[model samples]
Target: MTLKDFLKPDKQANLEVFSVSPRLIPVNKSINFNLYINSSAREGVDRFVCIWKAGKAIQENDVSEIAKKFGHIYIAENQRNHFFKDLGDNKNLATKEKVEILKNAALDHLDQLFHNTDDMIQSESIKKCLVECEAAAIGLMESIRNYDLFGLHDLIAELDFHDHYTLDHSINTGLYNMMLFREINPNATNEQLKIAGLSGMFHDIGKIKLPNSIINATQDLEPEEYIKIKQHPIWGRDLLQQEGIKFQRNHLNIIKNVVYEHHENYDGSGYPNGLKAEEINIFARMTSISDFFDAITTKRSYHTPLEPLDALGVIENTCGIKVDPYLFERFKRKILKDEKLDSALYLPKDFDPCCPHTALDLMYEDEIQKSELNENDQEDVIHYHWAKKTQLPKIS
Candidate 1:
C-alpha cells in the first residue's frame, strides 16, 4: 500500500493498527517485540496474525522467510514505547539500523497525528495520544542525542520531494528543530528536545483545519484568506488543549506557545499578533528557521524546490525578515558541519518507503524480480518492501 493508504484512519477498522520497518527488528536474537504478517482477509480489511512472538529467538533466515511473501510488518499502536525503548537499550544496534528505525517511526507518528488529531479532540483521545507522543519523541531524542548537532543525516537522505508533503515536512521540521535546539544548548535534556521537536511538528497544524479549496483559489490570497492562513497558529495552540484533561502545564505551555507563535515573524512584520522582536517566543523563533528551510527545499505547488545549499542562501536573504537572524546562523553552521555526510543520500519516498534507504531497490530491480531463494541474498530485500502488509514489528 502507499504510505498515504497505510496511514489513513478510515482503514483502521480492520485488524492492522500501525506499521513498522523490518530494519527496526534485530537479527539472530530473541526480540522483546512481536512481529506479524497478514492473514488472508476480506478484500478491504487487514487481519494480522503474529508470526514472531516476543522473546522467541529470531534467526536471520526466519525473518527473510516471512518477508519473501509479505513484505511489510505491523505493530500495535500501544507498543510504540517498548519498541523504541528496546532500540535504545540494544547497545549493539548499528548506526544505520537506528537511523532506519527513527526515520520510519517519525513519519508514522507525525502522519497519524496530522490525520487523527481531529478524532482525538472529538473523542477525548488527546490524553492517550499525548502520552504516546511524548514517549516516542523522547525515545528518539535519547537515541540520537550523542550524535551531536546531526540528528540523523540519513534521515536527511529521505528529505527528497514527495506528494505526502505536509507529513514529511513536519517530520523534517521536528528533527531539524531538535538539532537546532541542541546546537543552541549543547547539553539539552530529553525534556528540552521533546518540546522543541513536537512544537515544530504541530506548528502548522492550524493549516490542516482550513479547506484546501479556499486555500488555493487564487495566486494572490485575499485579505480574508490571509487571515485564515495566519490563524493556523491559534488553531494549532487550541488543538492541543482539552477540557478537564490534566496535561503537564509547563511542557504544554512551551509546545502550545511555539505552535501559536511560530508564524509571528522576527522584526515587526508577522501576522495574527505581529508582536515584534523578543515578543515572539524562542522555541517559535527556532521553529521558524527550520520550517522555512524545509518549506523552500521541498517541492511545493506554488514554487520549485531549491537545493539545500541554494535554499540556505535563500534563507540567508530572509534572515531578519522571515526568521530570527541569530538562530538561522546556528542552524546554518549545523547543516554545513554535516553536509558531507549526506552529499548524495536523498531518495524519494515512493522508491524508499522504509527509511535508511540504501537504494538497493533501484540497483537490483532485475535480481529482485527473478532471484531464487538463497541464504546469502535474503538480507538484501529487507531494506524495501515489494508487497504490503502491517508489520511495524508489533509496536513493542
Candidate 2:
C-alpha cells in the first residue's frame, strides 16, 4: 500500500489532532516540543505524517510502530521558525523589526550556549555550541538579506551594548562581515553569507580555552601572559579541526580558515603563521576588519573604549598593515554613512556645539600640560581642545 493509503476519514479529522505545545524551542539537539495526535482517529495520524512529509519537515524516514500507531511524530522544532514566532506578529513584522528579532535570537542563543555552561572551553561544549552557531548564522543571513544597510547599521548600534563582551563582539563581527560580504559580492548566495556569518561568530571560540585571569585582566598583560593569550588562534584552529568531523567539507574549510587566519595581518605582521595579503582567506580578512573594529569600540577592562569614528580612524591608520586596504576602504565608507544616519536620528535636536571626547583628545597638548588639574577640570580641557579643532562636522 502507498503511504497515502493509511488515511481514514473521521469526525475528529476537523478537530485539532496534531499539535506542538510550548511553542518556543531552544537551540539544542534535544526535543523541544511535544507533538500530540488525537487517539480517537487513525486519519489524524496519517494526516499529520502527510502534512509533515509535504513540508519536508521530517528528515528521518524510519519511524517506530508505536509512534505511527498513535500518530505522534517526534522531531526537533525549526529554530528559525520558533525565533520568528516568539518575536510576536511574525506575519506582519516590518523589515527593521525582523532584523531586531533575528539579532536578539542570535544573542539569546549564544548567551544560553556559552554563558550558562560550565567550562565553555571544553571540547564537547565547544562542539555543541558550534552547531548552534551555524544555525544562528543562517538565521542572521536570512534576516540581513531582506534588510537594507541603513537598518542593519541601526540594529547593530542598538544592540552593541551588552555586559558579555565576548558574545556581543562575536555577534557584531558576524553582522559586519555579512554587510561587507554583500558589498564585495552583490550576487553572493545565502550559503556564502551563512559561511561568512559563522566564520565571524566562531573566530574567537579558541579564546575560551584561555584562563579567565588573562582574558579579563585589567592591568597590562605581562609579556609571558600576552604570549599565552596569543595561542588562542592555534587553540581555536585545532578545536575547530577536531569538531570539523560533523560539518560538510566546505563548511569545515571555511570555519577552520576563519578561526586560524583572522589574526593574520595583511602585511605579514599578525600572529600564528602571519600570512600576508591574499594568502589569508577572504572571509578571514573580512572577519579581521570587523573583529578589530568591534574590539576597539567596545569597553574592556584593559582600556577605555574609543568612539566609533575614532576607532575607525585607528583602523584607518593600520590599513594595509593590519587589515586589507581595499576592503577596509569599503568598510570605512559603510560605517561612516551609518554613523551620519545614527547621529541624525538619535542625537538631541539642541545638542551642544562642542566636539565629543575621542581617542585623540587624550593626547591633546593642552590637556597634557595641565599640572594639577582636578579630574573634572582635566575633562574640560580635553573637550575644549577637541571642540576647537574642527566644529564637529558629521563624520564623512
TM-scores, all candidates, are 0.61, 0.62
lDDT value for model 2: 0.57
Compared with the true structure, what per-residue lDDT tens digits does model 2 show for residues 291-344?
876665655554566666665655554555666777766655654654431111
Tens digit of per-residue lDDT, candidate 1, span 232-321: 777777777757546688987888888888777665566668866568888988888777667655555655555666556545544555
Error at 53, model 2, angstroms: 7.4
lDDT of 1 at 325: 64
Model 2 worst lDDT window (10 residues): 344-353
For all candidates in order, the CA lDDT equals 0.60, 0.57
In candidate 1, clashing pairs total 12
Candidate 1 stretches with Cα past 4 Å from truth are 1-23, 27-79, 88-120, 139-154, 157-164, 214-218, 244-246, 334-396
Among residues 3 or more apart in sequence or in different chains, the pairs in candidate 2 whose N, CA or C atoms overlap within 3 Å are none
Model 1, position 295, has a per-residue lDDT of: 62
